[model samples]
Target: MEPMIWRQAEQALAGLLAARFTKDIIRKAEERMRADVHGTLPRWISAWQRLPQTGSLDLEATRQTSAVVVSNAEPIDLEPLTRLLMEFHPWRKGPFEIFGTRIDTEWRSDWKWNRMAEKLEFRGKKILDVGCGNGYYGWKMLAEGADFVLGCDPFLLYVMQFEVFRKYAPQPHRHFVLPLGDTDLPDRMQCFDLCLSMGVLYHRSGPIDHLQKMHGTLKPGGQLLLETLVIESDQPAVLVPKGRYAKMRNVWFIPSVAMLEIWLERTGFEDIRILDVSTTTEEEQRRTPWMTFESLADFLDPQDPRKTVEGYPAPRRAMLLAVARK
Candidate 1:
């Protein structure tokens, strides 16, 4: 399969990369994608491309539920579309609607969007989303009136998920989902007007370095929106889970909101604001038809909802907004 992001590099980035700094960022992004394809990636790409080419794809995306509706189509072939989409299983982020097929993902995702949307203004901004699963929020960002959105995630399935939507959506050039992560980002490129890292901080073994990378990606005075799992506490504290938090083996540092503020200050981010802090609910994340797997419900302790099955504090997320220091 041809590289999924090549067309975006050629078409969408025409005038956007006139600046030398941004051009190099794009160049490194391309190199990373080329170097990373492996395992079931080729199969996933083929399945995505094989999806029926339908016309009259009126792409109406919304901030509510992160749903992208493809209406006014010429009799969408749902059976084959379902078959092809299922090839890339375990859909985590979106709750997208393609030709009336509601992909009820594992995470309602829109719940998080609703909490953060009021605090953020995406209009006319060049945005970068770290760990952007399936570009769901990227679409929401576009709907919020973003000029351009670039999402980077190491997950190949999520990249394929974006391709499935792009095949039918109009003005897809405005959004591009790259197969990369926070560590892979170009150092201090200072390209984007806004940089967002959601549900990613805990996964990083090196939280301080992750903060630095996020800080480096932003232009001076650019806004950085961070959402992460945090432990509730009075004093400054961080939970380095001995084994796993919520059955997720890779989770490392989950800090209190107070600790996070200090970390952001230390990392050279200014004007920090804590937007919202809410514990994730079962309604917000549960096993769905589209993502039929163990979910937040499975991760929680049966006796007490506030604790995980592993007995850690149940997932509580915090949305933080900060300005990149000049």
Candidate 2:
């Protein structure tokens, strides 16, 4: 079936007085929409018209068919989608805005927010900001009373951003440092009370391998606060052909929720929890209409707990924020 928003638009267009119009004009409009356009507007119109009165559309049931093939399309830039969500519907303060990025309302709706606050409030806790882009979260932790906060990133560009933050918002114990990768950390192994490993796992060729190294830096019983894109289904998966990862060779895989759970277990982590999050918006849905490889716009809805694209049927999208004890 077509998107509800587009269907409503089509219905509004159909109901308009057409005495000033002729059959030829309508035919030409349909022709233009269908002939070599990025999306098939005519087909969408037909689906929209049929949607209301149909016996049983059963979109959820239709998703499980054996013939379904996951779409391999690249996501259009997510910034527009994020911006759209931020503008129209505000995600309340629990998870709230990370700098400008939209995320879940509460970072941990299941876990005690006060417990997290306590961890952040620890008077002399050492913190490591892994892939700490601009150290936004790092600075927040520092302000919350962490005794020491060290932000690390492989990218020199981001390291420079951290430097800028240090110069303007200097803190006695908070410092930003650069590490090229696992091998570059200082000789004495330092343990941290909390590790912010957000938005870094999906961009790697071997996520766990890097994660294990990150885990090595933490003290026993240290907490790893992780956030990354994740798949939702139980079935084992395959990478999309010619997918976005192809554009960036270092991009490896996005793990499923279950896979991540197992990885944490194998790596000796305990008390793991998965948080469902969406990072897309309505205006974003409008600006980049071609992002759907197989009618995937629906998966972008923040309210829906399940993450899967339309037509393709696989659980292709979601944000996973998990915390595990080391």
Clashes of each: 0, 3
Model 1, span 205-246: residue lDDT tens: 999999999998888999999999999997789999999889
Positional deviation of 28 in candidate 2, in angstroms? 65
TM-score of 2: 0.50
Write out the backbone clash pairs for model 2: 94-105, 95-105, 95-106
Model 2 Cα shift for residue 250 (angstroms): 3.6
TM-score of every model? Answer: 0.92, 0.50
Q: Once superposed on the true structure, which residue ranges of model 2 sit more than 4 Å away at CA?
A: 1-123, 171-173, 186-190, 235-242, 245-249, 282-326
Report how far residue 136 has shifted in candidate 2, in Å: 1.1
- Give Cα-based local distance difference scores for all models: 0.83, 0.44
Q: Give the poorly placed runs of model 1, Cα more than 4 Å off.
A: 2-4, 14-37, 56-66
